[model samples]
Target: MNRTNCGYPLLFPRQNWRHYALRSLQFAVALYLLAFFLFPVGFLFLKALQNPDGTMGWGIIALLFANPVSWESLQNSLIVATGAACLAGSLALAAAALFWKSDIRPSPFMELCGFLPLFMPAFVLASSLDIIVGGHGGLPAMLQNLLGISRANASLLSLTLIEALHYFPFILIALHLSTRASSPQAHAMARLGTSWRRLIRQVFVPLALPGLAFAMALTFLKVIDDLATPLALGITNMLAPQAYHRIAVYGAQDPLAALIAAILFITSGLAWFASLGFIRQNVNLFPVTFNDNRPPPTSASMRGRFFITFLGVVYLGCYAGLILSSLAGVWSHTPLPETYVLTHYLKAFRFEMSSLYNTLIYCGFAALIDILVALPLAHAIAKAPPHWKQRLGWLVAGTLCIPGVTLGIAYLALFRDIQLPLSNLPLDATGLLLTLAFSIRGLPFALHICSLALNSVPASYIEAARTLGCAPAKIVSRIVFPMLRFGLLLAFTLCFSLAAVDLSLAALLVPNENNAPLAYSIYLHIQSPSGMNVGSALAIISFALLALILFGIIHRLHRRQGSHRTLSPPLFPTHRTTGFAHESSHH
Candidate 1:
């Protein structure tokens, strides 16, 4: 029987029971996404455009257009977003070029270590920076006192720099993946005596443009939507901070806050679509092929080793600064902490244990729900009809484009007056809403990872099972599920860590102080004059927990990789089954 573009058999009629089941499952997932993800966002736009008199209008928008505060905030967001994206993209591209293309010989462990900042909470990273470089009490302040330079926080610059540090790894990883696919072009051009500069400018850059654009777009969205960094830095004029302040201070009844959220949502959506276009256009820009095109590994030069060492030391030093500050009894007016003790850690664990428990409960539940929702959607996307596939992609992308802050704002608007369907509880007053919000916000990540894993399942195995009269359910249980164990674990861990420290949703959706998660509690502590040490301690504990989970995932993945390598030599005849698809019969 012939197969459609995907691996499923086309000989089976469209109305086949299996196909119908798949369709029904996909339709259900589509409905869930629409009702829970898309509807709230649509309602946000509607609310922003509607006046209080229950009529369609754009008066608020008109007023916002005329407001100088809106324009200035927009201007600031654009400037900072653009600047941070460029800086991060350039630095990441350079790093990828050196590590992958040049004789850098950057150890895989070192490169992985460099990506640690990507998983750290934004507030934690921001707080770490303040400890290392804040005006009156940090190491940089001490240096400034000696140099006689004025020692006030450089708010905007500090934000940009902090964002760049957190975001560069994303671009670096994207470029690295792109280069993996296009390395033959680089090797072939270099063989013809092309200068490294020309090779990058003419060959690699165009090939990697899609990934580069995506990295920049993601960086921009993250920077623009960040409430923690600006709030932590005490910046009030920025767009995200301004929007947050309106609702946080004036309550959710403020129409102006909804207007700002609408603007943020629209801006985020435009950037996401624009970046998708760039990605699609650049995907096959340099079409070159080779039968066996792996490039030979290069050795590190002395200079290259020195460069990697320098970056490694700088990153380690920043982390050390956080750890040291967390342990300091009193750190003011000193080059280093005057007294180092375990009091801060004890205080955090003793006093903030409830907050930590709340984080686990919330994030653990969210991750579980995220996986449950993602698995069916991912399976459907991989096996659904073409038209349905496109619709599913849009659904996922639309959810991804909705910023977390916008989602929080949307939920706040939509459910502030609604109660649970059968219960007397207000929707916003229970942990259910928080968990639902987190699961929806994390859906895109879970779906993407699950889809990739599902795509990698060997078609031959499924075909063999089908030919033997095995049901679809049996094939999934015996073959697909077993192979996907690692990926599922990875998705769950990533979503859990992210949801655990998600201040954006918790800051708005959480019922009250008693139920706040660790990140929210840390933020609360950081806001007080005497609470910096406690906040540092909380940040330390949170970072350590997240790091442990991340490292566990990494270790398991590495072990799986090694096992795959050991088993591959004897698993089957030479046409290898990899992440997606097997070699054609010609091989």
Candidate 2:
């Protein structure tokens, strides 16, 4: 028997080591999900059932349903969510179909327009729209004169439209990706003399259904979970706002708040479960291909381009009030500000620097955690057996069903009595808990992107490295990391941005005003008449900073790609390959 240094046996030693390492990593991921994600949420449900006497019962839920306001809130939430989903889905489908079926190309500017909403908080958009049309002023006056509608009706319409606008991009992106995935089938059908309607129905629709369903479901969930938008619009007859009211007025220890959160969780979970079947049908087997050799653009294509540009302009125009408010020195009952100054911006930096610091510390930590956890988790899921793969993937995706407010409520309930190690302060009161909440909330997104990144790397590269006696860590560091750096950076940026704008969690989890994150601080500022300009200033600053960061990251990644293309190492060295082959032959 031949023995290697520090090895018990050489026979299948690599296999043994690899198996243990994989198992250990999987176990670690499982433990993390259980501890941070499952445990807290489970505790919330349990707490909702706990009676004042410390016995388990459904009395809290019974009480919740008994209240007329609660029932109305539930109905309103359902209506808004469903309406927003349908509206957004319709717009996204139309835009996607036009781009896919027509000669019109989606410009980078169009893509940026779709992506912009993801970084903007729902409340910010709601507030901006309110400024434009909330009261009997400006756009609202003109609309009322033209349409003859009451202010109350207009408010409700604005709320629904705001939600739809904020979420349409999700469906658009999904449909766009689905089109790419189904391109080959589409081309084949076209070549076979298929009718336009038949090709669309048979090839495009079926392939896009999964993505469409998932996106609609996601939009519905987001709308349902949104607390800030309703609150900002002064629409309290919604589930999220009601839940926040319960907590805010009755405190975190309130059983009714827990009950409302539990209901929200159940509602979102059902929606997610309904969409799971569609999600499971998604298959990506080919690279995305575009019609690069198309003929000259026609009138229809020109119309399509014009329509897309119009949509982008309209969406950006929605933020005109916000931009003006940020720059305004004074304005009262006017279409625009009377004077413009940098005073608001100066005030935001002077007094709200702590909020910025807190946001960076909390969201930055969360994004880091997401990348670290998602990298291994994505790899493990990719390597998992088919049955386990589906299960693990759904499990990660299920995090979407756990709303930010639900998680925040859960953390407050679960960790109310739990203290940080060696500290007298409760665990729920610290920024650590907030960071963990952000991580859990952002994990699904990070996981999805990381999975895509991992899938892009060929399996043969990893296997070759292993066969060349490179350790798993070395394989990832040398081969996987280099290839995945861009994707990882993108995931980090996305997670950080998402976490930063998450007003629901920040509202519930913020320890105090002094330590509040920027989103929560902005919310506070918006609530005050004197602070409205400062709030707008803060929002604008946040947006500009995020945009600058994203631009820098993209530029860096592009530069790195160019450098790598010109001066990169061989993916697999010839000498190492020969040695590995020789060793295999000897064995």
Candidate 3:
């Protein structure tokens, strides 16, 4: 060996093991993400870019922009989305302000009730809205008829109302946070000999602006991207739904749908970026404090209270509409149906049993397996030194940015041509492959939830176990698993819930009827004639199944949380670092 200034260093080559390991991990993550999300999207974009002769060209894009029909549909979509966002944002803001800021008697439950719309299927909501709008005999339409309005006029109005009602919770959560985050110091300064208008303009609005923007951006994305609503509302010939139709019904004709999807890919990406930008620019730096020298509480007048009560009543009525539609025998055009039957439930269950079975198998297995794998992955990611942590976070973050449909397509592009033989097993079965896809899709989410739980773990306990000579495996099993069970349960339940209802990949991976999930099966039923009753049944059954699962998960979670709250020790101060440091000085 050659002598050097530092002779010890010259004895061997220094290994940068962390860099090598991180690079390898990043490569694996990239491969999985591209296979699952990027390639299929790129493939479609490739198709969209080609001419009939298969040469790369923008002729398809040109044709789409030049066509009035496509423009009209696109324009209609934008207009409707704008209306929905404004209405939803306004309602959410009002509700959040009224409930969260004030000494409202019923606080948390009201907030929870407002979030019910999220659980609703787009088609089911549309169907319920339709029944309410058949309002020549319906309440709103009857009132409008008394004022001498036409049925045509009512449809447009109904669309706005339905969308607003369904989407307002987005704004409520956002604004509620904004309201809460307004530092009491800021409010105090504003209130001390300041004009009310100036106080709101300077203190409240500026603080709340970020929340408003977030809510609006999210609301806009939902309204614009929704396929079921537009289709159910008979706007299928429009841009967004047309894009869907090209994939589902009209793939043989022109490839306009690909172009529209490409547009969505670009636009939604830009929107998300803009939203993130706003959030980054405006996030509060100061600590948010509860109002002290409590601003004298205000109460709504009797008339105002009654008005709020009426809004609540209407909300309950809409919820009832969802329940009744699921059970109705035949919803004749009436104010409200007087009769109902279980035929819808029975028919749907019989028709969708196979689909339900397939979906359950895939979702349940994927979720369970994903959580199992993610435990190690998340521990590594979370517990890694700061120098390495960001690589793992960024790798997962990239997957999160890609839309589900795009990721599904990536899997198609990557795996479509590959074949394998592994230990006498067939390397590719549709069900098994789909299960893998679902699991891969959920990795980012699993990583996120588990990492948060892992981060919360007190390192002292871990060190104590090590000091007692515990093995790594034993330490993880005995100490870590029990502490983080609630988070894992949440991760699995959330993952399963998402996979159970998803239809984004249905077209790409599920071709045969037997492979259809509940959502896809219902979509198929609705696409054909004579599927209304049975379709409603399927929709309702799907809803019921989802509801039951959700209830069970939440109930279990609540029990666990209650146990933690009751059986666990009271809170104590800790340092923010060294893996949740305990009080060094015993008090």
Q: Which candidate number maximizes lDDT?
A: 2
- CA lDDT of every candidate: 0.70, 0.74, 0.57
Per-residue C-alpha lDDT of model 1 across residues 1-587, encoded as one tens digit per residue = 44545554332346688777767776887787787777888888887887766777988788877988889888777777888899989998887776545533344344454445445566666677666765323443444566665443355666777788777766775666555544554556667987778867765666566668867887888788888877777666777888888898887767778888888888988887777665532221111122233335445345556666776677667666567777887778786888889987888989989998998889889998889889888766756677777676656755666667888888888888989888998888997778888889788778776765665566777778878988767777898788778768877876887787677788888999999998889888876657777877898888677667756755664566534411111101112222222332211
Cα lDDT of model 3 by residue, 469-581, tens digit: 77656776897778788778767976776566555555445647778777778766655546655766777676666667556654664565523421111111111112112
RMSD of each: 5.9, 7.7, 8.4
Clash pairs of candidate 3? 36-407, 37-407, 40-409, 40-410, 135-138
Query: What TM-score against the true fold does each predicted structure earn?
Result: 0.85, 0.85, 0.74
Question: How would you encode candidate 2's per-residue C-alpha lDDT over 130-205 as one tens digit per residue?
Answer: 6766431334444556688986555556677889988887678667765643444455566698776776676567
Error of 1 at 507 (Å): 0.9
Candidate 3, run of 10 with poorest lDDT: 568-577
The parts of candidate 2 lying over 4 Å away from their true place are 1-25, 134-154, 180-203, 280-294, 466-473, 553-587
Candidate 1 displacement at residue 574 in angstroms: 27
TM-score: model 1 vs. ground truth: 0.85
